[model samples]
Target: MVVRVFHTATALANTLAADVARALRSNPRLVLGLPAGRTPIPLYDELARLHRAGRADFRRARAFNLDEFVGVTAKHAGSYRAFMRRHFFDRINVPKARVDAPRGGARDVERECARYERAIARAGGIDLQILGLGLNGHVGFNEPASALIARTHRARLSLKTRRANAPLFGDRVSAVPREAISVGMATILEARRVVLIATGESKAAAVHQLVEGPVTTRLPASLLQLHPRAEIWIDRDAASRLRGARAAALRRLRRSRRGRSRGRRAAARARGSR
Candidate 1:
């Protein structure tokens, strides 16, 4: 697991977007696991900007959303399908047919989930999965629990999650679906690379737990700690509550940067003096 801290949201977005572009360049057919939420908007926006700049291309890539409201369809204004189209897909070159999102409105939900998993296998698994940290440390609606589901499955949404998504439903928390179809924890862990991003003081506690806390099913995100290739990107506000070695390491990194800056300035001054 790797943690990257940025001083500002823009810095974080730019850095991560560059990383994504590099990955896409490395594998033009990269399969992506994407998340939907306010936290990832900046990154999506940056990636779209990168595409426009010719720094990245998505025409050959495929994408799968992390989750969707159980009873919702693509036509719903607040559906994740709609969200991705508005925030990302419409702005990039990726074809609409190449994007695969769970069919929450399918007549046979279980069969639909099985089909989604099968589709992933046919595509050779996901190359990289982008995620967002929930206020409760949940990942893709895999809420805090004694044990988490292992594959793509239907999950009950926690009240907090519904409340968080209320704005999408016209600020009526009750309008938010109480259930969702999500890629399970085990499925997420299987991805070749995982990138979880968080920002703002509201996410400080969850970010702290994700980085320094114990690995338990209670906070599903802590499972990322066990993944061999997980990258966490967050800004100073989201990293505010981290402590112990994690905190010290960030401090040391800052000091090293300052030292390098001063040394470069001194070298330039000496050269001018000579």
Candidate 2:
């Protein structure tokens, strides 16, 4: 696992977008596992900008969304399908046929999930998977549990997950679906490269735990620790509570800068150069 901290949400977004664009340039047939959430909105916009400018070509790329609301159709206003179209697919050059997602409203959601799993495999598995961290430490709706499922499956959305999704449902928690079909942790770990982005102070605790805590199932995102190429990308606000690794060095740097500032002030005072 790798942890990268950026100065601001925009910085993280830009860097991540560049990384994706570069990867796509290297492999036009790249398969992407995408996420839909507040954190990825800017990323999708940046990728669209790259496509429009002809900097990155996605014409041969294929994409699979990480999950969708179980009760909503793909055309539903709040479905992840609509979310991706509005935020990403509609703006890129990738053909509609190549971008698919779990059918949230399928008559048998579990079957739809299994189908999605197979579809990903048929596409030769995901080359790159981008994720957004949930406040409760989930990735792709794989919530904190005693054990985790390895294949795409129907999942009961946690109350906190529903609340977090409320904004997309007209800011009404009651309007958010209680169930969803999410790609499994094993699938995400299987991706050749995985990057999880988080921003804002609300995610500080979870970010801290992901980088500084144990690899326990209670914190599902921590399981990324086992992935060879999994990366946690966060902004300063989200990394604020972290205490080890680069976080400790950042704190020390700040204190050193302050000390130098104080020394300069004292020297100026001694020279009567107020």
Candidate 3:
């Protein structure tokens, strides 16, 4: 697990876009697991910018959304599929055929879950998975007490989650679905790389729990600690509660600068000696 702090959300988004662009350059066929919400909006915007600049291409890439609300249709304004289309797919070159999300309105939800899992397997799993840290520390709707090693499945939405998402449903808590289908913790852990983005003070507590607290189901994002290549990017506000983490990041930054300075000085001295 790696935690990186940026002064602003835009900076964090830019850095994440650079990483994603690099990954795509190295492998155009990369499979990306995406999350929808305000936190990743900037990142997707940045990627769209890169695409327009010809610095990135999504034509051959595949995308899978992290989760979808059970009662919503793909065209619903509040659906994750609609969110992705509005924010990413419509802006990028990725073919519609190559993008997928859980069938939130499927009559056979259990079968839909199983089919989604199989689809991921057939794609050889996700190369990079993007996540947003929920206020409750949930990831992909895997709410608190979610099994540590579960696979793609249906889950009941917690009331807190519904309330938090109420604004998307026009501030009507009753309008938010009470259930969702999410790619499980086990499925997310299978990704080659995972990037989690958090911004603003609203996310500080959850981000702190994710980075510094114990690995427990009570804080689902804490499970990222077990992922081999999990990277967390947060703005200063989101990292406010992690004073020790902030200090450590600053120290590392200083050390890196010192190392670069010493190398340049050594080169200058070598030239003078010559």
The runs of at least 3 residues in candidate 3 whose Cα sits more than 4 Å from the true structure, single-residue gaps closed, are 146-149, 248-274
Task: List the candidates ranked by TM-score, beginning with the highest.
Answer: 1, 2, 3
Mind giving the per-residue lDDT tens digits that candidate 3 earns over 1-274? 9989887799899999999999999999999999988899999999999999999999999999999999799979999899889999999899999999999999999999999999999999999999999999999999998355389898998999999888789999999999999999999999999999999999999988898889999998999999999999988788878857566775566567689899999999999999
What TM-score goes with each of the models?
Answer: 0.92, 0.91, 0.89
Clashes of each: 0, 0, 0
In candidate 1, the residue pairs with backbone N, CA or C atoms under 3 Å apart (3 or more residues apart, or in different chains) clash, namely none
What are the clashing pairs of model 2? none
**Model 1 residue 195 lDDT score:** 93
C-alpha lDDT of residue 114 in model 1: 89
> Could you tell me the TM-score of candidate 1?
0.92
Task: For candidate 3, give the lDDT of residue 136.
Answer: 94
Candidate 2 TM-score versus the reference = 0.91
